[model samples]
Target: MTGRLKDKVVLITGAASGIGEHTARLFASEGALVVISDINAAAGERLARELGMHFIAADVSKEEEVERAVSSTVGWHGRLDCMVNNAGMVGVVGSILETGAEDWRRTLSVLLDSVFFGIKHAGRQMRELGGGGVILSLSSLAGLVGGVGPQVYSVAKAGVIALTRGAASELSAYGIRVNAVAPGLVMTPLVEEVYGGHDAALRGGAAKSPLGSAAMPQEIAASLCYLASDEARHVSAHTLVIDSGVSAAGAGAAPQFHHQPADFLGRLPEQYQ
Candidate 1:
């Protein structure tokens, strides 16, 4: 509504749903020329049509697809000002002993490798075309501390934070900024399914936050909008935590879940609370 990103060209991977979808909507609302990339071609195309933007089908786990997606955006828009590496999955969802090596690698391939590819390609493009671009990736509160998510997910998300910092150092000279967003307990479709539905998930997840609430995709999107815009020109290599103060709270300071009979749709991991 503010048109804070007026005329900026932004490419957001995994823009078909969740945080990526909301970010795409917010970016467009703020007057950015949005290009959404996702493996879900049907959803991506439909959303692009509604937003009057473009869609690129990309399985971000692969480097070539990531590179092509970036190139395709630059080809259509003539330039790129921001790259949102938001494609991810909550893969390998079991304990350490139950987790297989193949599953672990597969999860990392999607969650972590995709981000690295986005940075590598997008950073190169921005530099080649006179530099000066913003790169934002999705990390998580699980990455910030221990006992939050499953083993593999925490590792990958943590890698995103580290990658953001390292890339920022290298790309800042070219006027390019790299950052990551670490959010806690967002009520996304995936999370909804995991917790046996919206009410149960929201009740449990929100109980842990010091603010007595959880994050929504749109809220995370709003944060990304600010970071992608000129407002964050001086901000780089930062992992903006949008967790309702859950990360700030001490390990024991987190609230305990009080599940009523009707509310206990499924038991969430103790690690989460």
Candidate 2:
């Protein structure tokens, strides 16, 4: 039997590790013509070799690099059927006051700017190839709710959703679908860094989730696979959130402002004092 993504060309940015890596593996298992694009040339090329897929080094934050990645994919496979804008970083980790202009911009460059470039270049390629392709982005639960992530991280992820919706509206006419996946508390190396340690992050994520367990990278990968497949042929301009019900329960990993205003204001508000 043929796979869900049989013979389709897919370019996933940041395919070296974590969610992107898992997605690449899954996409290949489903018979996709996968191209692993990442700044980590060593890891990306290794994964490509393992899966018998292609690899291209590109920083998604830059427009020219993104265009080259898209063009290279087409040159190799003749078309790009799916473009997964999965490259990102946990940008601006400290309080908003501590965030300098350059620091904030750097974070946005990684998280939000990358998505914009991905949509632009991929949309162009799809349209130039006569239209009809899937564009999936990695949003986050913090984008929808308050207090789950650092200041700039949440802001950038939210921007991704808006970009997804706006792009979907524009691209749907050409049969290209744009969608985002927002995962709440996933246990990955990136999450480990944010929470300070791998085990601590796991414990915290599990404690905050109603399911009593944190989400794994594969779960998010599965959702992304669905979006990139023909099964979601009609799905676009939508942000499918996968949080295992944490968001619905009004639970968050951030400290309460009333109790810990220090996290926000770096001190008690004058009114409170």
RMSD of each: 5.6, 6.3
Error of 1 at 120 (Å): 0.3
Judge candidate 1 against the unseen true structure and give its global Cα lDDT, from 0 to 1. 0.86
Model 2 vs. true fold: TM: 0.91
Give the per-residue lDDT digits (tens) of candidate 1, residues 1-273. 999999999999989989999999999999999999988899999999999999999988889999999999999989999999998877766566556677678778888999999999999999999959999999998899777777778899999999999999999999999999999889898888768899988997788778888678999999999999898999999999988876677544221121112122123222211
Can you tell me which runs of candidate 1 are displaced by over 4 Å? 252-273
Model 2 ranges with Cα > 4 A deviation: 256-273
CA lDDT, candidate 2, residue 11: 97
Measure candidate 1: CA RMSD: 5.6
C-alpha lDDT of residue 108 in model 2: 86
Each prediction's whole-model lDDT (CA): 0.86, 0.86
Local lDDT at 163 for model 2:
98
Worst 10 residues of 2 by lDDT: 264-273
Candidate 1 Cα deviation (angstroms), residue 45: 0.7
Error of 2 at 48 (Å): 0.7
**What tens-digit string does per-residue lDDT give for candidate 2 at 204-226?**
88888898998999999999989
What is the number of backbone collisions in each predicted candidate, taken in the order shown?
0, 0
